[model samples]
Target: MNPGSLLAYRHVISNAGPSDAAPVLVTDTFPSGVIFDSAVGADCTGGGARCTIDRLAPGDVITFTVYGRTDTTVRGTFVTTATVASPAENLYPDNNTATAITTVRIFVYLPLTLRSYRP
Candidate 1:
């Protein structure tokens, strides 16, 4: 993504269990390069860091779309993290968190002048 451009992040949460998971909570932490704009989802609210799901049955899936704008002066790469939690007992804690790394590409424009001479 380029500087000052809009960026969207999609997070897919799935329940791969023999039981239903209730009261699931999803949280995200945007890096310095991203200025959080908004979020779109069933239980998502205003702002940029958290989402909630009342319940998720077996083989059920939910998703959240998070939007943000790239900082004009930001360069290089930035990292963002998202995590999910539930009241139900979790066997694999390692799969509860996800990380994304994004690289920013910048373009510079310079003024050009043309000169003419009489022959």
Candidate 2:
């Protein structure tokens, strides 16, 4: 992504349960180099860091699309982490956290240099 460009991230949350899961909440903390732009499939809060899902049925998956504006003043790889949680107990808690990585490219304009003139 370039500076001041829009970067999009998709997060998939699944309910691999034998029973229906309760309301799920996805919280994503965007890196410092990105500002929260907008989101879909879920309601955003905490400056687009937290998203809420009404509920999830068994074996159902919900995907949330998050948008962010790349900060023009920053560059390099920025990491955004999203964590999902529900009131119901999860057997496998290891996959609760996910990360999205973004690398910002800054174009550098250089002036023409005259090293040697052989005219």
Candidate 3:
């Protein structure tokens, strides 16, 4: 199988409040087809929640949506910060440039495994 055909999935983590954040960095990248289907903590550092997923492939679209509980104080936030590498590989363009993933909406409540082709 081609590496471009692999599926990668990860929970985009970052600090949020008001002012500038301390920069919640993502060190590793997920392989294509692997879905992050489990509840994860809102903490900058991954903890508490279980990070689990089935699997997926590239070219697949994983949509995310978020909902806040009634008693919850602060609403949960989700963000994606990844850029497509050079060569202008296999990617669907919205206008002209590579697909810009700003944020995945958290609607399912539970953590979901999202799949995308690896390259």
Candidate 2 to truth, TM: 0.84
Off by over 4 Å in 3: 1-52, 70-119
> RMSD to native for every prediction?
2.6, 3.4, 21.2
Query: How do the residues 2-105 of candidate 3 rate in per-residue lDDT, one tens digit apiece?
Result: 21121223343222223322222222222222223333332221221222222223333233222111222222332322322222232343321212232223
lDDT of 3 at 92: 40
Give model 2 RMSD, 1 decimal. 3.4
Worst 10 residues of 2 by lDDT: 41-50
Where does candidate 2 stray beyond 4 Å? 46-48, 110-119
Better of 1 and 3 by TM-score: 1
Measured against the true structure, the TM-scores of the candidates, in listed sequence, are 0.83, 0.84, 0.19
Report, for every candidate in turn, its global Cα lDDT versus the true structure: 0.82, 0.83, 0.27
Using alpha carbons, what is the TM-score of model 1? Answer: 0.83
Tens digit per residue, CA lDDT, model 2, 27-116: 888888677888888888656577888889988998888888876787888789889999999899899998877777788778898798
Cα lDDT tens digits, model 1, 1-119, are 66888778898999998778998988778787677777788566434567888999989998888887877878888898989999999998899999988888777878899999899
Instruction: Order the candidates by lDDT, highest first.
Output: 2, 1, 3
Q: Which ten residues in a row have the lowest lDDT in candidate 3?
A: 65-74
Model 3 lDDT vs. the true structure? 0.27
